[model samples]
Structure formats: structure tokens, C-alpha cells
Target: MKNNENSDIHLVINIAQQTLILYQHNKKMAQYAVSTAKNGIGSQQDSGCTPLGKHFIAKKIGASEPINTVFIGRVPTGEIYEAKLGMLHPERDWILSRILWLGGVEEGLNKGSNSEGGCDTYQRYIYIHGTPDSEPMGEPLSHGCIRMRNEDIIKLFDQVEAGTSVVIIAH
Candidate 1:
């Protein structure tokens, strides 16, 4: 992405507050409640935790998909999420609406592995995405990704593009 593409807007996810704040030109534009990893924060593969540090939106998906549209492997599953469907598949980790696929920028912390124990955020498929309405927000409940409400995700997706900067902070 060009350097100017995301110079005006950025995102900050505060794990402690369980909130995602959107900033444009260094001013707060919006804030939304979010759910981080239930397992807490880590950068190792399969750790089921949210990785910290600097990241950028590597991909923007589901541009025109309807809210509650299900996604598997970042591909639309053609299934709209609802109460009945969620009940039918109790074990499914629902990735709904849009996806802001994140790629770490700080090497060894989140971008790439290093001697001190690190992993790739993109490789781990870490994303800021939609979750079912039934799920709780402002809490640590997701497997790893930052989970937002379906409507909130859609709103965010429309406002940002690939290459937008994001920062995840433990405090």
C-alpha cells in the first residue's frame, strides 16, 4: 500500500477495555465494543490468544455481502447466521459479515518469528471480524480474533480499506 493510503486513519484495539477506537487525523472518529481472545494475549501459533503490537489491514473482504453472512476460511459460506443455525452447530466459530485481515508490521513481535519466541499474525489468520449477535461484547470470548457486532463490522469495513493501520495493546 502507498504511504498516503492510510495516513489519515488508524485503529487502536484496547484489550483491557475491550474496545476498538477509530481515529482519523489523530482524532477519535468512532468507538465500538469488541471481544478479544478468551485465552488472553500471545503470539504463538495455535495459542488461541490475541497477538499484540503494530499491524495493518492486509485484506478487506465481503464488500457487498449482507450482514450475518457466514464465512469459512475467509470465503463466504452462503449461510446467513441466525439463532437456529447457531444452535444447529454449537461448536462453530462464526466469522460473519466483513473481515479486516491483519498482518503484523513489527518483525519478531507479530510479523515474523524470532529467537525470543514470536509468530506471524497474518499467518495465524488474525482478523477484526463480525460475530453473532448472541455473542457478548466488551469481553474476552473469542478464540483469537477481535470480534465485533455484525452491524459494527459492516460499518467499520465500509469506512476503512486495506493497508489501514491497527494497533493492539494489552493495556
Candidate 2:
């Protein structure tokens, strides 16, 4: 295998600054603006808040798909996002381009129950995915996922793989 494919890759999502940094072999590769949950951070299920702590890319979805392709339930919906289409579905939480589903590695904090209900990141369907181009970046405005630009998500998707380590921090 090529060295690039075998190198260690890690992601650090900073909620406070609303940015996601990509690190390869302990060196910074790229950084992208992101929008975290509007409700801020938490681990409880149904909180509609982004879970914080150690995580990993459990699944990488929408490879080779066209940019702006809409996804629902992690499945491509055969519709490419456009301004007109966005206007037609104003209530939709658009998951476009690509998706990097996250699974929390920290138990009782983000992986499992925490004296309350379930806190599993995978179960909660937390992801670093693309949003509509109209949506503002570097702002807390998502339901629970980390929202990125369509092109940016595609770029990030190509550089990382499933099981890549991630750490989401408040600051």
C-alpha cells in the first residue's frame, strides 16, 4: 500500500471556534470551517446537540457522488441540491455531498448512557457532513452534526477513511 494510505490521520473538531482540523502523521494537513449544533454540546440522545470527546469515523458515505447530492438516512436520495430545491424544502436539514459518520470512543460521556438516556454518537447518527451552500459556516447552526461546505466535505472525504480518530472539543 502507498504511504499516504497507511499514514495515521486524525481530526480535531473545535466547537468553540467552529473549525475542523485535519492532521496526518501528527502534522496539520488542512483546516475547514464548520458549523456545529445550534443547541451546543451534550451527549444525551435526542438532545439535538453535538456530542463532545473522542470519536472515530465509523462510516464514510457518498463517495464519487456528485457534489450537492442530497442524503437521507445515509442513503443518497437521487436529488442534487439547488437553490430552487432548497426553497421547495425549507424545513429539511440537508445532508449533502458526503458524510463521515462518527462513533464516540469515550464511554459514559459520548459512547453510551450517562445516567440519562443513550449517548452513543453512532446511535445518534452524528456526522461530519455537507450542508447547503447558503448555510453559513463557522457558526453553531446544525441540528447535531458538523456541517461543512459540499466541496470541502468531498475534499475531506477523499483524504480520510473509516476508523480515523477524531476528537471533538468545546474549546
Candidate 3:
């Protein structure tokens, strides 16, 4: 990751290309392949799908935890991720490494339009987090949150903080 004197990092996620771009201020720093929701994209509360449009890192979790540690609901489970262990829990969502919790910036689309009903975006609990090593990285495979490799997630976790601007653009 490239360091800049800028106060915030700009993040762009492309679902079609399965890539995440990190920019310090306006300068490109790093780009890594990612896996998004298997159900495709949309910005809806309780959709169990990836949201598009503008979002922000509402919360940051797992700061000093070791890589490949298992996390459930953004809290480390104290069990390290292992291939055999993963095979045991074949159905686990498997949030590993770090978590960058995302909350929708667009009120209507994500937070719910007044025409629809009042819904809380933050309660939806969308995030960009790490997945098990056995999982495919450059494909759409998550329930909703974006999934990245352990190393990539850790690197990204260090570069950005809570409230960092994250833009999800569909191709």
C-alpha cells in the first residue's frame, strides 16, 4: 500500500471485475481481486445482497488479530482458520483476518426510501471482510459482504479507517 499525506483513503469496488482499488487522497495505491455476493448487486436493506452506490466504512474490527483467525459477526472467535477446520465447518460464512463494516450513504436506495419505509442501513451489517483461503477470491461467492484474501484484507485494513469513503460501481 502506498502512503500519502492525505487524511482519508478512497476505495472503489468493481463487482464485474472482482477488484478493489485503494486510493490515498486521489492517488492510486493498490488494487486487489475480491469476491462479492453470489446473488449479484443491489442497494437494499435486508436484501442479503451486495449494495451498490456510495457507502462508508461505518466500523472497523479486528485490529491486531493474527491473519487467518476466524471471525463471526466481526468478532474474533479465537479459533485460527485451518484447511482441515474449514472442512469441518463446510457451511460457515468464515469471516477471517479483518473487517471493514460498511453503511450505505445513499438514503433511499440503501437506507430505504421514504416511499418504501424507514429502514436502518447500519442494522443491515454489510462489510468488506476476509474469507477462508480455500474460497475462491476473484468471483462472486458471498451472501452480501465483499470477501478478500487474508493478506489483501490485512493490508487494506491498515490503510483505511472507519468512515473511509467506499464506492461500489457495477460494470
TM-scores, each model vs. reference: 0.95, 0.95, 0.89
What TM value does model 2 have? 0.95
Global Cα lDDT for candidate 1: 0.92
lDDT of 2 at 4: 24
Error of 1 at 134 (Å): 0.6
Worst 10 residues of 3 by lDDT: 1-10
- The residue pairs that clash in candidate 1, if any, are none
Candidate 1, poorest ten consecutive residues by summed lDDT: 1-10
Q: After superposition, how far is residue 160 of candidate 3 from its true place, in Å?
A: 0.5
Writing each residue's lDDT as its tens digit, candidate 3 over 18-125 gives 999998768899999999999888655556678888778888889999999888867888999999998888888889989888777677766655465543346677
- Predictions in order: lDDT: 0.92, 0.91, 0.82
Full ranking by TM-score: 1, 2, 3
Per residue, candidate 2 scores C-alpha lDDT tens digits across 21-88 of 99988899999999999999998999999999988888889998999999999999999999999999
TM-score of predicted model 3? 0.89
Best by lDDT: 1
